[model samples]
Target: MSRIGKKPVPLPAGVTATISGQSIEVKGPKGTLSFKATDDVTLTQEEGAVAVQPRGTSKRARQQWGMSRSMVENLVTGVTQGFKKELDITGVGYRATMQGNVLKLALGYSHDVNYEPPAGVKITTPSARNDVIVVEGIDPQQVGQVAAEIREWRGPEPYKGKGIRYRGEFIFRKEGKKK
Candidate 1:
């Protein structure tokens, strides 16, 4: 039995879900989201909760069962509370700023880097120094992907720990070379 699949996904107040064939749609205050599950899994709603079960005992079916349930749960949470990711910029000349929809970044390079987030995702610099950035979206995956893309511009190096990194991320320091 799949433990994650067995747990029912409870619908919070003001959230609604609908099942059509293999696809499920969730609507809440934030927005509406939908997911299509594989044929190996069965999705059903009962008593204001959603449930997923394997159509057969095969390994593929069991795998889809848990995955489907998680997708549904993520939709519910997304429409209700949404998701967010934070990034921290570190270095002597590293900085970030937002001009309209464009994100301007300076990371010790000869030229500044400008980034535009995809649809449905919002990026903002909350501090005047433009060192901290916040990415917000209804989909957790999109929010995380955007944050990763921004961090990729200047990954943290062990020496001096200069670069862009996710909040709370740790960079191991290295010793300086002997003179």
Candidate 2:
């Protein structure tokens, strides 16, 4: 049996969940989200909770059942409380600003980089140096993807440890050679 799949997902207040066909949809105060169920997994939305069942005893089916259930649970929680990703900018002259849902970043490069926040994703700056960028959304997948894309704009350098980085992330600094 799959431990994760065996657990029932609790529905938060003000959130509604529905299972239709092969997809599950969740609507909450934040927004609406949906996920497709795998072939080997079955979803049943009961009274105030969601349950997952594996179709067969096969290894793959059992594995997918747990994953699908966890995914569904995440969707429900995301729509209710939302998710966030924080990144810090390092290096002189590196900064970020929000202009009408667009994030413009200066990363000590020749040109400036701009990122347009997707629907339901909010970006905010808490400091003048643009060292802090907070990305918020109801969908964890989307929020994480956006943060990753932004980080890719200017990855951290091993020599100087400069660039955009996630909060609590540790970057191993490489030492310079002495000739």
Candidate 3:
């Protein structure tokens, strides 16, 4: 038995969930999101919570059971509180700025890197700190993907540890060659 799958996802106040056939739609103050589950798992709503159950005793059904439950929980959290990711620029001249939904990054490159966030995601560089970039969106996956794509442009190096990285991330330092 899956411990996580056994627990029902509770709906917070002002949030409503509707299960129709193999699709589930959740609406809240932030926005509306829908997910289609596979036939291996069944979705149901009871009282103020949503539940997921496996259709059969097959291994595939068991796998989908827990995954479906987590997906449903993420939907609730996404609509209610949303998701956010923070990126920190570290270097002598590394910086980030936002202009009309476009993120301009300077990572010691010859040309500035212009990144345009997708429709639902917003990227912002706080005025107080140009080195910090904030990614916010109702979808957690999109927020994380945008942050990762930005970091991929200039990942932190082992020697200097200078580049774009997630906040609170640790970069292992390497010693320089002997003269």
| Residues 9-31, model 1: lDDT tens digits | 99999999999999999999999
What are the lDDT scores of the predictions, listed in order? Answer: 0.94, 0.90, 0.93
Error at 33, model 1, angstroms = 1.0
Any runs in candidate 1 off by more than 4 Å, and if so which? none
RMSD list, candidates in order: 1.0, 1.1, 0.9
C-alpha positional error of residue 114 in candidate 2 after TM-score superposition, expressed in Å: 1.5
Worst 10 residues of 3 by lDDT: 120-129
Of the candidates shown, which would achieve the greatest TM-score relative to the real structure? 3
List the pairs of residues colliding in candidate 3: none
Q: Name the runs in model 3 displaced over 4 angstroms.
A: none
RMSD of 2: 1.1
lDDT (10s digit) by residue, model 2, range 25-104:
98998888999988898889888998989888999899998899889888988887889999999999899998887899
Q: List the residue pairs that clash in candidate 1.
A: none
In order of appearance, the predictions have TM-scores of 0.96, 0.95, 0.97
